[model samples]
Target: MASEDLKTIIENLQKKGKMAFLEKTTPEKIEAFEKENAVTLPEKYKAWLLYSDGGELFLPAGVQFYGIEHKPLLNVNCEDRPSDDYVVIGALASGDPILFKKNSEEVAIYNLEGGKIEEDEKYSDFDAFLIDLPSGILGIGE
Candidate 1:
């Protein structure tokens, strides 16, 4: 899926009045997160933080992306992060982490039992993951 497809999905969701997003976060806060974590966020993900921060995308059972100010990333202030090389962006309903590689666009799901990425599930970037999200979660496109 492409970025245009993701935009269409959001547009449709908005047309249906089903989209929900948290308040946008400031660049300063984003910078703070980067400085504290010693990692720079990918450009697209940074854009997202500025746009919606994070929120439920499709309503009930929707993907709930984390926010900077509220519902912070899973690794925030935690010693037991899923992976030192990854930043947790959110969790699946079952609590498996949705991780984004630090200083890279790579994204994947972190399996709790395995304590590692499910390699086959990896996406090239944040937009790619989101492009697959609706169908991946609820068969929306299918």
Candidate 2:
């Protein structure tokens, strides 16, 4: 579907209380994101971009703007080295949350809500991380 059409669908979903976090994104910014991460995004994720750009893809109540651009804060910290395939994006859940992963590599979910990282063994990789966003999974724990 076209970006505008997708926006409407997302908006409607939000109205029905079935979705959370919707953010707008430009094609230029998408290209910039790929360039910065040195990795191509997955088709499902691209479809998401076609629908919206940055902030909250699903939730509305907990969403907030960090700057004039309204970009959501995405934090990714690697212990050893920065992998070539890492891309972080905002995702929909109970609220607008940041999703991240290492290129095509698998990532462990770490919940930082309790002032600590909690790991979920079932999820792995960047794609998996995105898939599990609704469940409040962050990334691998230290």
lDDT against the true structure, per candidate, is 0.70, 0.41
How many clashes (backbone N, Cα, C below 3 Å) per candidate?
A: 0, 17
Model 2, position 99, has a per-residue lDDT of: 35
44-119 in candidate 2: lDDT tens per residue?
Answer: 4555654544444333443221211245433333222223233334322333223334444444322334422235
Candidate 2, lDDT over the whole model:
0.41
Please report the TM-score between candidate 2 and the true structure: 0.44
lDDT of 1 by residue, 1-142 (tens): 1245456656755654366787888889989988886778877777777777877766666566787776755355443246577777876666677778777898787778777776667999877777666666445764
Which candidate comes out best when scored by lDDT? Answer: 1
After superposing candidate 2 on the true structure, give the runs of residues whose Cα lies further than 4 Å from its correct spot: 2-28, 57-70, 73-87, 91-97, 105-109, 113-142
Which RMSD values do the candidates have, in order? Answer: 3.7, 7.7
